[model samples]
Target: MSDVLLFSAGLDSFPAWHYLDKPPALYFDLGHRYRDQERAAITALVDRCGIEVSVSRELDLSRWEADNAIIPLRNVYLAMLAANRAERIWCVGVKGDATADKSPQAFRQISQMITDLSGRPVWLDSPFWQMTKTEIVAWYLGQGLPAGNLLLTFSCSRTDSAATHCGRCSSCLRRWISLVNNGIDAPFETDPWTWARVADYYVPAMRDGTYPDHRAEEFFAALDAVGFVPPPPAHPATAEDGQR
Candidate 1:
């Protein structure tokens, strides 16, 4: 069976298109808050790259996303519909992703369910499950793809019609982390280092083992790159210090 990717023109999905051998993609305009932004990016990239991607606006999932950007079980709906085109469905699930719907277990269950119901083996998977966004970007660039094109991918979670990324949002922050670590420091509307979440949430959360160790190191490294995080104090003098 052929493969199809559930593309969103985001940091993760854009690179995934390349990783999966340029499979046909399906973009579902679910009428979310940032649909316009995402759609614009999709259009820009598609025109530039000439990739075959079908945009489906048949489903308006906006009603479910009224109070929050998160549409619960959204992946389930997208995966089921994407199976119509190809038995192998590629969804972007990164290494540190903890979302219930995007987890490995969830995909396996969903794939099996879809296969049984459709009377055919439909597999939904992500090739980046073991790789973080930063590594994914590195791989994309390693393929000799243009950085300008990847920059065209949008990862903001804001509702504004801004020309730059809202670097404070979780999506934007993660995007910044990936790009910064990959030696491509794309500009954002607000400096991601100055984002309140970095100091109050991400720094602490990543430090306290809430986030994976590797991810934390990369994040700290990114912060270190811009000198956002202060250097650790000189090694504390041991008891031998008194002798010295």
Candidate 2:
């Protein structure tokens, strides 16, 4: 039996793909907006590493009407389907520095749900679950993986057909800020206010007594270091929208 990787064709998954000892099975489809990039990345990865891939076009959940961030329990469903097709061990590309809400706890819940539904033993592997993004990047580089292709991997929550990145989404913004902080200019660095817009939502909530009082100072301090001024509030958006 071989391991199965829930490959999303993003930066988070790069390191896991490189380090898998079993040459795990990689899954992908045409549903996701970044299908082209995903396919290219997976193909290149397979070529470079000689890994086995089992592609399925049957599951195209991205077209269905659903929320952008939380796509109607998509991962849980994907994991269950994948478990049936391959070995029960599944690897996901989730990192600690990304956010607390989308933490390992969330995946644990999904794993438990899948086990309950399938009535079979399954493993959910998250190699970077406790590691920061910086650590992940360093690890990939240390492994001699193509670190340059990282810029091409899409992480934007917003779907865009015109550009490689949907700069307005929280994922895109966070990624841009991280690259900037790490002194790496992202490929889609055209939008300067991407991270600034994120700070906008965060700063007001902290200042107006909406966020925890303890976090206000730390938030503002980070913004100051980044030289960003948050924008005015538009409407009450959930933490999933702004932070996740």
Candidate 3:
């Protein structure tokens, strides 16, 4: 039996795809707004890497908000599905993440749950658990993977009508920061915002209850050194709109 990878065509999965001899991959749509964009990226990567992929188109969007693309217990579904196809499953659970499902404890518990139900020991592995996103990209670069392959990955939380990265979303911001910090000049367009403005927008929203200020504050805070804006009085009146 071969290993099954819960692939998302992003930085986390890139190294796994390169190192793992083209493991079978599974992609979940989960009714996300950027699902089409994700699929296109995945298709391009697959064409380049020659890996087999299975796509799951989700029908129900009722479980989560349309704007916020997190599905509750998504890892559980992925693990169980992977267990059905292979005894060993691979995922990218990196360091310092708030998501409870991606934790080591959660992975162990899910492995046990899969074994109990399937009557077979299913191995759930995350090789990049100890590495950060920047480290992972560095590893990929050192491996001589074409830098052009980097453009095939997508990490935007929100998508426009054209299925492009919103760039203002937390995911886009973090991806941009990771690439820039790693010395890769990413050619993606995101809405411009300074770290100060991100805090100014989210901190008050946390108080007034307009935006879900969970990752917004934390991500922007992480980008303190690298956050680049137009610098000073770019839009004094519409600074609020820049947060969007």
Candidate 4:
């Protein structure tokens, strides 16, 4: 068996793809709102690379109503499915981003469980376990992976049949913030939207107890905890200078 990857076709997963050099990629369609777009983006990414990597799809529909973005025990199901095909499986989990099914403890227990259940040595690997998504994007670029290829990947949590990003969503906002902080000129508004704008919305919401809609406040608070302050607005004349 070959190595397997839980590829999600987002910024985080791309670095794993780059470093792994196109292992067999496994895509899960767990009835997330963005599954169609994510699947399409993954197909496009593999096609663009022209690499001989196998992609397997699993459609496991769920009706859990926690968040449209979170699938209950998603990584566990993905790991279980992947273990049947490969002795080693990799997922793009990063530091400080663990959920119930994605924590270090969970992966360790799952690895042991897979070995015991399958009666073989099964390994679950996350090479980027210590890096944040933003850091992974930076690492990918530093490795000379083309930014244009990355632009084709999708991360927005909410999109329509057309696969257009809803700019107001927390995922969209996080994408924008991460790219800007890493000095990537992602195809977004050229107008100077700042962390200050996020604060202006988040502060009052926290006071009135309406802040954590879909954990938007928590997301922004993490960014703030990392000490991201808004930069000063540049002169309007230089806005379109194409300097990134």
TM-score for candidate 4, residues paired by index: 0.75
Q: Which digits, one per residue and each the tens of the lDDT, describe model 1 over residues 43-155?
A: 99999998788999978888888343788889999999988888899999999777879999999999999999999999999999999888999999999999999899988
Query: lDDT tens string, model 2, 68-183?
Result: 55556566667777777665545554443223324577667766776787787666657766555555666666666665666756666554455467566656655664555444
Q: Candidate 2 has which clashing residue pairs, if any?
A: 200-230, 200-231
Best-fitting candidate, measured by lDDT? 1
**Where does model 4 exceed 4 Å of error?**
51-58, 188-197, 200-244
Can you write out model 3's per-residue Cα lDDT over 43-130, one digit (the tens) per residue? Answer: 9988987868898764444356445667777788778877878888998876655476787778888899889988889978787777
Residue 54 error, candidate 4, Å: 4.2
Residue ranges of candidate 2 with Cα displaced over 4 Å: 44-51, 63-69, 93-103, 116-119, 192-196, 205-244
| lDDT of candidates 1 onward, in order | 0.88, 0.61, 0.71, 0.69
What C-alpha lDDT does candidate 2 achieve relative to the native structure? 0.61
Q: How well does candidate 2 score on lDDT at residue 101?
A: 24
Pull out the clashing pairs in model 4: none
Tens-place lDDT digits, model 4, residues 34-103: 8788888877888897534445545555566256567777777788888888888997777665577786
Assess every candidate by TM-score: 0.91, 0.70, 0.77, 0.75
Flag the better candidate by lDDT, 1 or 3: 1
Model 1 poorest 10 in a row by lDDT? 229-238
